[model samples]
Each structure stands twice: as C-alpha cells, then as structure tokens.
Target chain A: MIKLLPRYILSFILLVFLQVFILNNIQFSGYINPYIYVLFILVLPFETPKWFLLFIAFVLGLTVDLFSNTPGMHSSATVFMAFLRPYVLKVISPRDGYESETLPQLKHYGSAWFIRYSAILIFAHHLFLFYIEVFRLSEFFATLARVILSSLFTIILVLISQYFYRRDIKR
Target chain B: MRSLLNFLVRIHFLLLFILIEVFSISLLVNRNSFHKARFVNFTRQVAGNVFVKSNNLKQYLSLTEENQRLAEENNRLLNIIESTYKSDEIFFRSVNDTIFNQRYQYTSAKIINNSINKKHNFITLNKGSEQGLRPEMAVVSEGSIVGVIKGVSNNYSTVISLLNLDLKISSKIKKNGYFGPLMWEGQGYQSAILNEIPLNADIQVGDTIITSGFSSIYPEGILIGFISDFTEKGGSFYEIKVNLSTDFKSLDNVNVIGNLLQTEKLNIEKQAEQND
Candidate 1:
C-alpha cells in the first residue's frame, strides 16, 4: 500500500483537511498559528524533480491560502522556501544525498539533521509569509517577533507529527 | 520545439515563484478598499466560531475569579449611583437602564480571535448584529476603550484592536481636556502613543487619557490609557507614550458600546464633510 501513489494522495488530503479545519482553529496563544500543512511539501520522495517539488509547494500553499482566505500569502512564502530548498538540502546533505525512494524524515536522516533541515525551511517560509503579510520595514521588530514565535510553534507541531507517524523509509 | 520544451522545464520553479509574487503584490496593493475588508471579515467569522468554543472551555476554569470581579465591579458602580442620586430616582432607573444621555452601556462578550502582535491587529467578538452590534460601535475592555467595530455578521463582529497602527482615536487628558491623536506605536501590546499634542501644553506623567466625545463611535470620558512618558518631537508637538489599560494578549471579554445617536451624527458629519 505504501508503494502506491494513491496512498500518499490519501494521506495528503487528510492532512490538509485536518490542517484547515482543526489546526488552523487551534490558537494556543495569539502568536502561535501552527501550520502543519507544510508537511505535504516536506515528505515528497527524495528523487522528486526540483521543478516538481516547487510546483507541489505552490499547490500546497495555494490550498492553505484558499481555506484561510489570505489570498497569496502562503503561496508566495511556500514557493520562495521551495526555491531555496535545494540550497538548504545541499548545505545539510547527508552521506549519499538520500536513498532513492526515501522521503525526508527523522527515521531516514536522524533527529539532529532532520531538525536542522526542517528548522531552516520552516523559518524561511515563515519569514517570507509574515513580512509579506505586513510589508514594511517600519514594522521590522514586530515581524521579527512573529517569525520567532510562529517558527517555534510550527517546528514543535511538525516534530510532534513526525515523531508519531514515523515514515517507512530507510537511511 | 523539443529544445524549447527542455528550456521551459528547466526554469519552471522560477516561473512559479514569479507568478506567486505577482499575486501577493496585487493583494497587498488592493488591500485598502472596502471589498478587501469585507473579505477579511468573512475569515474572522470562521475564526470566531472556533474561538467561541475554546473560550467556553476556559470559562469553566476561570469562573470563580470572573464572577468575583464582576460582583465587586457591580458593587462599586452601585455605590457611585447611590451617592449621586435620590433613592427614588436611583430606584426608578434599573441597573441595566441608561440613566443619563451620556451614560455608556456595557455588553460583555468573549474575544474569539485577537491579534496584538501584528501591525494591523483585529479582534473577533462572539456577539454581533443580533446583539445590537453594528459597524462603528466602540469596544472596551476593563474600562479602557479598545476600538470600534469594523465589520459585523449575524453572530460576530471584527474589531480594530487599539494596537493596530492604522487606528487613531481622539483622546484628551483627564485633568485639562487637552486633546491629541492616540495611536499604537506598533511595539508592545501594553503601550501606545499620543501624537500631535502641542509642546507648550502642560503635560505630566501618569495623567489619564480619556475619549474626548468628539467621535460618534466612542462616547466622551471613557478611559483610553495613562500617559507614561513624553518628549518634544520636531519642536512643535509632544509625542507622549501611553501604557494601555487593557491587556489585549490576555483579553477574554469586551464591551461593545452601542451609541444611540450614531447614525444621525454620522449623516450630519457626512454632509459637513461634503460641504467642506
């Protein structure tokens, strides 16, 4: 079942629904809006083409935007992060890039490396999303505060999801 | 044709990024109109429903403290009323009835969604159109004025929390009635600034800031904040910082002040504005 495309598609739909309906509604603090939908962009196969990955990120973000009604905020931010993902991966590249069929996960890359990689991507996405939401250098300090707080919340949610749903990919 | 196809495939990600950026830029530029505010209000309604349930859960835990606070506040209000009026007059007007034409009405509703950390902060309330809430009604929490209602649905309304950079209210010093423009400095939730007060005016720290009754939204004499610090800016005006009384971050309930004569006052003002 895990070998099939339908399995991943099913999981993706479920995650997106849960995100828009449940997680988006969960406001732990005013600052913490956990965006767990980014997991769709994160767990794509290692061999997925760069162009395909970027396109997936665009769709993933646009879907969230459609539900949240924030217009292009998530899409712009996600695409920018997707554009930088290659460089981020290169910087944190494992011994053999990644196994051909393995997806990015702690089970595949270990906790430390996965955490570092996810943190960079999540921060990059959040920084772009928040700054664009309120586009002004005059609001720099406020934007920075949002970046740190939202990133922390996003990271914690992502880590918890990763811990519970360990992927079947081998290192 | 094959070579062209390969070239297109090579730069697909860059094309996608450009497309999304263009979309975002357009949204930002077009955000000022009423259409956009209405759209944002719809999003607030969805947020409000979720908040209502969560706040309901917390209400159980915080009931004892909230009840005690409400009772003590009611007692203080009753004592003030008793001291000001004859026993018969006091008895004639019920506690909930509006006695004086200037008296402000208070409606307690939970804040479903509040964002103080953003440059443009908005708050979603659990009460709305059915509860006599309409656009432009003033909101206050714990005696200090928050902001006016910007949008309303049947069961919810979005408030422009005082922390927003876009909101400016007319406020006066409690002691002297010297007026200034009150706005959030886009910094902390607890602080705001009063701008355009003349430099020569007698100003001091800890002076109370209250609504000036100049606007139809908020009635006069409602507390805004306290003057914490001031400095001469640009040699003509004193820029004063205020410590906001309402803790927006921990805001649970608010009173949406329904002004009786707002529509009539606004029509007159519109006519005046047009003539000017």
Candidate 2:
C-alpha cells in the first residue's frame, strides 16, 4: 500500500493535466468530450477501502472542475461513480472473486470484464455529469445523446490507453 | 449503546458517501450566490489563463478571417461617421444640437472561451471589472447581439450567450415594428424562436428582426436575425423562427456595452412602483 501511494499521486496529476489541457479542448462535433480522468478511479485495487475511494474521487473531480470552471458538476458525478463502483464489482465478480491486491486493470482482468466494468461506470458518470451541467428535463434527448457519445469516446480512449501503455500493478 | 456504535461503524462508508454527495449538490445549488464568488473567481482565473495560452497557439490559423471581419467593420464605421457628419451639418443649420446625449459606451474584449453546444452556454471574455464591466452589460459582435454579462471577476467575465435557454431578448420586426420575445430552443446554433407576435401583423419569411430596446440591456435597432419561417400556434400568435445574424461558433471579438442612463431609468421606475 505504501509503495502504491506515490504511483497513484503521480497518475492523478498526469490524468488531471491531460484532461484539462487536452481532452477539454477536443470538441468533436460538440457532442463527445472524452473524460479520461475517471480512469484513475476505475483502475484502483479492488480492495481499496470505500471511504478512501470516495475521498479520492471527490478530490480528483474537484480538481477537474476547478480547471473546467464548472463548480460541482464533475464532483457530483464522480462521487456517484465511486459510490456505485463497489456494487458494480460485486455484480461482475467471477466465481473465484477478485484477488485481494490486484488492481482492476485491463491486463489483469482481461478485456471482457474490464470493458463491462468501464462501460457501466463511464455511462453512469457521463449521464450524471451532463444532466447536472444542463439541469433541465426539457432537453432530455439532446443531453442523452451527449451522454452516450461522450461515454463511448471516453471508454474507447480508456481502453486504448490501457492496452498500449502497460503499467505494472504491484501485487 | 454498544449495539448502536457497532451499527454506525458498519454503515460509516454509506454515511460518508451521502455526506459528500450532499456537499457537492449544495455547492451546485449555491453557484450564483455571493458566498461562492471566491471559488468561482479562482476557477475563472485558472481557466482563463489556460484558455488564453491555448488560444494564442490556435489563433494564428484564423487570422485571415478575423482580419477580413475587422476590415469590413472599419468600412462600416467610416460610412457611419461620414453620414453622421453630413447630417450634423444639415441639422446645425436648421436647429440646435441639444437633442442628442451619449447614452451608451462600448468596450472591446476578446472571447477566450465559448460554447454553443450546451443547454446553458456561456462565453468567457478577457475583460472584467477592471474594464468597468458590470453583471448586466450587453455583449455584441460586429454583426449582431451576442449575449448579456452574467458574472465578472477581476480580469475576466462570463456572458450567458444568446444560445442559452435561460436568455430571452426583446426583438421586433424591422419593417413594420411588430415585436416579440426571442428565445433559443436548444437544438441548433443558427436558429431561435420568436414568440407572441400577433398573427395579423405584416410579416414575411425574409423580414428582419432587431433589438426593440424595451429592455435596457440592449440598445435600439441592433440586428438580431432574419425571419426564416412562421406558423400559427393557436389563433392569435405566430411562432416565428429566425436565423441568427451572428455565427456563435466562430465568435472572437466582442464589445461589452455600458448604458449610461440605465441606473437613472431603473431608479425612476422603482420610485413609480413605490408610489403605486
């Protein structure tokens, strides 16, 4: 756990920088804003304490919000994602269950489980984020399109990054 | 007591989650209040710096188009100046020059960041309180009305763009003087809806719309849009669609308008209401 602390801190800074500087600027047809910062929470070890997970998620989201100038939208969405992460893990747990010290990485869990896990959480995050940002039910379908397109883009980016850049998770 | 303590410990994670979520939502709801001003300003400064830096790198690619727009504006200004001088000379011979007062002043600013896709879109300007900008000033581009100032920090201000669903402008037909309230429908960037124009008013597909100046935010006769189509909603009013004159997607330079007589007008109206 002590050894992983520095790694998590480093990735948090790197992801926030990439998101604020690069991804926020990439408006592909004004619908897709790939939020790769959620990858920080997605890849945490399965046994990470729930309280710690929520705290980290809040900080990560608040940092992004400070950069994007949307006060609470990102933080609300990310906290909700963190709250749902454990239930999602429970639902998708294998017959043997997850290894205690293993991180939920694409390399560790294989493609299928990782895809399912990331897709569900990313969809939830995007839906919440878009709704909170818009804050209206009148444009429901338009906001939904934004959610789906952004979620798809974010998931693909997360997958591509995981596959190409292999990082060792100490067990 | 022991059993209650154990239960609380067991559900501590859930309690913490709820606490954090509630805090975030409260922050969202309190966004426009004065207490959130410091946080909003801090974020604005950070985002403003980043956008200004990135826009510097990207601005060169659109330099030619921007120059063309500026040159056209210069020509228009020259024409207005010459016409004004000619009229002034004619009026001076006929009557005294006491009828005109400078009611509005303009400050130019660059749009560092803008969005047209969201339901409540906002544009960030490089000007702020230091430039004498207030919360309700009108923002306009060379061609048409842009938006109204929503908030201001020290070095930057955010404008609620005309594309937002929350903003509605009083507009009128240019030819026949029939007027209505114009609002965005949140679908396309180019078109907006003008509501409550009477069905019997002389209107057409190609008629022009301009600011009515009924609201003090915008001055009179600024070009807003041209009527594209219309339909009768029930029996009395026409739902008119207008293609906006300013292309919000390519907005760069804008002017924030300061109405010199707004406070005086508002004060008089308030006094009248008090008497009534």
Candidate 3:
C-alpha cells in the first residue's frame, strides 16, 4: 500500500494535466469531447474499500471540474462510476475466481478482458455525464450521439494508455 | 433497536454514496447562486493561473497569426484616420479641456481559458480588477463581438461567451436598421438567432447584423454577423439566422470595453421613468 501511493499520485497528476491542457482543447466539433481523466477511477485496485473509493472518486471529479469550470457535474458522474465499479468487477470475474495480489490492469488480465471492463465503465460514465450536462430531454438523440462518439474515443485512448503501461512493465 | 442498528450498519456505504451525490447535485443546481461565488473565486485563483501558463506556451505557436491580425486592424484604423483627415475641413479652435470627458475605456487582455462547445460556455481572461476590469463590460476580438464580463477576481475574470444561451445582444440589420435581440440557440458556435424583426422590413440573405446600442453594454455599429437565413414560421417577426463573425475557437486577445457613462445613463432613465 505504501509503495502504491506514488504510482497513484503520479498518474492522478499526469492524467489531469493531459485532460485540461490537451484533450479538452481537442474537442472535435460539438460532438466528441473525449474524457480520459476517468481512467483513474477505472484502474483503482480491486480491494479498495467502498467508502474510500467513493471519496477518492469525488475528489478526482472535483479536480477535473475545477479546471473545466463545470462544478459538480463531473464529480457526480465519477462517484456513480465508482459506486458501480465493484459490481462490474464481480459480474466480469473469471471462472478461476481471480489472480491474487494483482491490481486491475491489462498485465494481469489480457487486452480483451481489460477492454471489456474499461469499456463498460467508460460507457456508463459518459452516458451519465452527458445527460446531466444537457439536463433537458429535448435534444435526447443528439446528446446520445455525443455520448456514443465520445465513449468510442475515450475507450480507444484508454486502451492505448494501457498498452503503453504494459510495455513499461516488460522493462 | 438492535435490528435497526444492524440495518443502518449494513447499508452504510449506500448511504454515504447517496449523501455525496446529493451534495454534488446541489452544487450543480446552485452553480450561479451566491453560495458558489466564493468557490468560483477559488477556481479562478488556481485553475486560472494554470491556464495562464499554458496559454503563454500556446501563444508562441500562433505568433505569426496574431501579428497578422494586429497588423490588419492597424491598417484599417490608419485608413479610416487618413480618409477622415483628408476629406474634412477641421476647425483648429482651442476648446475647454472639460469637454473631453471620455465615454469608453478599452483594456486589452489575453484569453487564458475558453469553452465554445458547452451550453453555458465561459471565457477566462488574464486581466482582472487589478488591471482595471469590472463585471458587465463588453469584450470584443479584433473587430468582432465576443462576450461580456461575468465575474472578476484579483488577477483573472470570467466571461459569459457569446455562445452561451443565457446572453442576448441587441442587434439590428445594417442595411435597413430593423433592430432585434440576438440570442444563441445552443445548436452551434458559429450561428445565433436574431428575432423580433418586423415582417415587412426589406430583408435579404447575407445582410450584415450590427449591435443596436439599446443597452449600455455594447456600442452600436460593431459587427455581430451576417444574416444567413430567415423564416416567418412564428408570429409577426422574422426568425433570422446569423453567422456570428467571431470565431470563438481562435479568440486570443480581446478588449474589455468600460462604458464610463453607464451609471449616468441608467440614473437619468430611472429619473425620467419616475415622473411617468
């Protein structure tokens, strides 16, 4: 736990920087605003206590909100994702139960398993976040399109980063 | 009592989750409320400075484009000065110094953070109260209307962007002077709707739209956009589409217009209404 502190802290800072300075400015049209910052909540250790997970997710969402000027919006969506994270892990657990002493990562699970896990969470987060931002049901289909496109991009970005992390472990 | 304690303990995590979500949603709903004002200042102090550093790094990449825009504006001003100087018969009589009361003061500021894709978009400018900025000032790009100042901190301020659905600018047709209120429909950044133009007005596609100066904020004759399309589907007015002139994505430097006479205008109007 002590050794994992620096890793989580470093990723948190790096992801926030990447989000505000780069991905935010790259919002393609009004359709695809990819949010890869939610990756932090996606890859937390499976054994993380539920209450602690909710707190950390709230803090993470508020951090992104501070930069983007969308107060409360991101935090709510992220907390929702954090709340559902355990159920998602349980539902997708393999037949052999699970590998001992392993964090949720592509190295422990193959690319296929990791992709499925992250995709479900990312889809849920984006769907919830966009709807809340829109609030009104008038542009339902338009908001849905934004959700699908943004989720696709976010999933692709998450996979790319996971593969890169996997390569670093090989060294 | 033992059974109730067990139930409460069993659902503790769920209770915590609900509590956190309720707090967040309250924050969202009360975003523009007074309680969030102080929190917004905190956001301005931290996030605003970080944006300044990043904007400084990004500005270098667009130096040439920025210089070209500045040069073109200078050239246009110079041409106007030269033409007026050559054509007018000026009287060089000495006048009282008290006659030169300045009505408008312009403060040039750099945009540090801006969002064009959101329903309620905001722009963060580098200058703030220390730089002689106040809320309710109009902001404009090179020669186009951008947004209005919303909140000001010590060294940073936020702007309600023209793309925001909550803002409405008084505008008129440059060709025939048919005035209306221009508003964003939250559809796209490049377009807005100008409504309340009388149906009998001689309107055409591509006619220019300019500010009407009905309010104390924006001055008249500043170009808002060109009329892109219009329809009479509603009541007695034409719902005209306008292609906004300012490209919100590329806004870098803008001028904050301080209308010094706004207080005077409002006071007099209030006095006149009192007699009625």
Over the stretch B1-276, how does candidate 1's per-residue lDDT look in tens digits? 999999988887678668766765566456445323665567556666766776677677888988988899899999887775757666565643744554456678777666654566777788878888887789988778888887777788777889776788999889988897898876667899998888778988999899998887788888988889999999899999999887776677788888887778889999999999
Candidate 1 chain B, poorest ten consecutive residues by summed lDDT: B28-37
Q: Which 10 residues in a row give candidate 2 chain A its minimum summed lDDT?
A: A162-171
Model number with the top DockQ: 3
Docking class of 2: medium
Candidate 3 error regions (>4 Å): B34-36, B80-101, B264-276
User: For candidate 1, lDDT tens digit of each residue in A2-49?
Assistant: 565786788778777787656765665554566777777777776677
For model 2, the stretches where C-alpha displacement exceeds 4 angstroms are A167-171, B34-36, B74-100
For model 2, how big is the iRMS in angstroms?
2.3
Query: What does candidate 2 score on TM?
Result: 0.89
Query: Cα lDDT of model 2 overall?
Result: 0.87
lDDT by residue (B1-276, candidate 3, tens digit) is 999999999998899999999999998887766223887787788888899889888988899998998899899999887876776443222122225766777889989999887777889999888999998899998668998988888899989899877789999999889898999988888999999998999999999999998889988888899989999957788999999999998888898899889999999999999999
Every candidate's TM-score, chain A alone = 0.89, 0.95, 0.96
Native interface contact recovery, all models: 0.38, 0.55, 0.62
Report the number of the highest-TM-score candidate. 3
Clashes of each: 0, 0, 0
In model 3, what are the clashing residue pairs, if there are any?
none
Q: How would the docking of model 3 be graded? A: medium
